[model samples]
Target: MGRTSRKRRSTLTTRMTIASAALLLGGGGLVAVNVYASAQEDPGQDAGGGTRQQAQQQGQQRQVATIDCPDVGTSLPDVPDGARGRVDGELATLDSQITEAYQRLASNRTAAAQDPNFVQNSILGPLKDKRGAVLDRIGQDIRRSGGRPPQGLDGMAPCTGRPSEQPQQPSQPPSQQPPGQPSQQPSQQPGDGSDGGAGDGAGGDTGNGNGPDASDFVDIKSVQPNVAVPRNQRAASRGTFTTACGRNENGKFNPDNVIVAPGVSNGAHHMHDYVGNQATDAFSSDDDLANGQTSCRNQGDKSTYYWPVLRLQNGKDEADVGADGGGKDQNVGEIQTPSSVTLKFDGNPTSKVVAMPRFLRIITGDAKAFTNGDANANASWSCTGFENRQLKDKYPICPQGSKVVRTFRFQSCWDGANADSANHRTHVAFEDPRTGACPGGFKAIPQLVQRIVYAVPPGPGFAVDSFPEQLHKAGTDHGDFINVFDDKLMQRVANCINRGDRCT
Candidate 1:
């Protein structure tokens, strides 16, 4: 079954039309408490009414954060070849249902505050029904294709309301700079008119009432240095291949995800900043990508590299304020273009590297890590000068004169057969964190390390675009890549790494 057999679904309609409402319940920036109700519970009575009142009196009500659902796509590993297209399309529909459900929750804050059960009866119940139907279709698709459907898929439909308590405070006061390191502030860069300052008000309501509260950011200086270098084995491939793709000066932005939702428009539900392969979109096939124009100085590399766009939380709006993936999805703010984007391929520390298949697809980090947990969370945030101090869950508060940085080191071990997988992740694996070795039966390939830098005023005033239900959480940051390098160039890349030579 070729990939082109997949049919495109109609464009995702823009359904988020809610006026901003203050969802904070208590003083000190605390959010509402989580409310779970049984079917017999009275709709008029608050599920956590007493606790809500007491917490408000004590100024410590837990915050009713975003929705949390099981990632069905990630759980299914045995989807048959003929059923992949249908499965992928249904997964995209599941995402759209969640986004629409979240919009209802955000717009009904007043009702939810009056009756805690309102969220369960009005929002979560319907969402579960919608997701259950989609999962059933997925199971049927697999069964019809001569594959046994995975068990317990229907049980994954239920989602819960997550509760957040308070912002994370620094362990200690801001520390002074180490000796020999001069104190300097981040230089102002053009793109998004953000004034250079500490951005003390960054924790305030982010134009959208949903997220990125003060709890999401921590001062980088307060964090102790946590990065450690892995030891290279005697047979390690030590060369590097750097590909210079411009910083997306052409402003190619979209909400489509070709890898996960090939035929579905607005599949990501959040805007992305594209760097290479101009023809990349939800509808592009392998052939279209192969023939696409390149942004790299070297035409041989037409690989597509992209990630969620980071935006300043300032009151200003971008051109897509009302577009499906922008404000309509609760991702409001001015999109900040990166000051620099470096695409470098590194070799394995334990063995010689091999060339990746021409169209291998890899996604690093988890876009829903806020609700899905940190098992696949791979985001790394830091400041220009303090690159040694990396943060995974919290956004970094870069000191004055320091710019923000996001880095993604993609998985380097390939399964040697399939270029992609049902979940879009199982085919590639990251080497062991401590030993730097590939898993058994896997081959080491040229690992792409993406380093992106942005010059925004230092503070929590910036956030990455995310699913509406994700609430723009920093932990959900992720990156995507598609290898479109021709055979000749791919072989050259592998040779350069094996011979320990640096090449462009």
Candidate 2:
């Protein structure tokens, strides 16, 4: 089903915070701890003397940003009433299936963790498989409904910890640069396309630092297209992207090539990373990155990048705005859907397509400040004794009654002045899957639109489009994932308009 617009408040606000890729660890090897800490340490280290201290300091910084949705519900606009009913019905069914599956598997987890011999191979390895199944089911629903995942739940995902705690301090520092670092010159830009390029520097040759300008942000009001019914019953007109070149031609913005790796299939392991081209390195460790399909951009290094963590610009009090307020809370983060499109698993080095779940924006919060008294002992786990401490490992495994809430870095995000700009603090987009089924050229998926704020400035000096040329281009080839213009969805749209509901 296409996205439906519900009522929202005028001052839509949210939070911005850093998101960590690994789970929060209460205790682990000092060596492992140090590795995670280096991401954000000061470059000026005192020879060998700075290692341990830097690690601890890095851990402390992690506690700064965090967010949680106490009870915030979904906010989608522009959908047919019939489509909305179908979605609600499907979601309810999925919830029941998931809840039941987890309950049945709880005992198996405890037994397997404590006694390795009792291990019976099941879905998703342990706790993660269960959750992954739920998400996968949601993705299928999108294809069945004739629309992709709605914008709000587009790129939303859960993360392990906060940035301050797990800041990415590259091993090499500025002082360690090669002798001619500054004079070495910038990397040569690829210019094979004679159609004229966007050109040099961060903002390109246009001399317009503002970047490719798009219209002011307009929230999705409804996906139900107007039906040729009684003339008097037609609804008011809404916004649409009509420019001939409105499609994203840039390599980064193109969505046609983006896809989740290992292509969706039975027994597919959600732990693979196409960036480095291998299973994630830390799966067996305390906090596993292998729980589900990791999001990746189809660009250089393919290194997992941060999903814009949302945090309130000002330290404002948390306010619970009803569903109509467009998710306005002190710590609301904005999650967006993929703006590009590509064909389903086609035959090519990277061609692939499969129904995937609708993703949601996830927010985690920092732990309380580090004090001298916090325990430093790493939690232990063994199959024989698994039931007692399974959840303690910082992975999602849990004993039947464990009540621990997973902790990770958090940032709240809501509407900023401009939601589409890359720096609209806390806005996130769907990562194009690294598996290369997407066409090489960029093209915009007309039916799909990315969610973001284009007007607000993200920080002290950064505006929403801070990194103009950096934002990805929409896809060029127009292969549809699911034809939303199909007769089935159209019929439903017409049915809703027949009722009192408004159609856009």
For each candidate in turn, the TM-score is 0.84, 0.20
* Predictions: Cα RMSD each: 8.8, 24.4
Error of 2 at 243 (Å): 11
Give the per-residue lDDT digits (tens) of candidate 1, residues 226-295: 6764578899998999998899987888898999989888899999988889878888888888888988
Q: What digit string (tens of lDDT, one per residue) describes model 2 on residues 225-295?
A: 11111112123111222111111222111101111111111111111101211112211111122222222
Strongest candidate by TM-score: 1
**Winning candidate number (lDDT):** 1
Q: What is the lDDT of residue 436 in candidate 1?
A: 72
In candidate 1, how many Å is residue 227 off? Answer: 1.3
Candidate 1: worst-modelled 10 consecutive residues by lDDT: 172-181
**Candidate 1 Cα misplacement greater than 4 A, ranges:** 5-63, 165-203
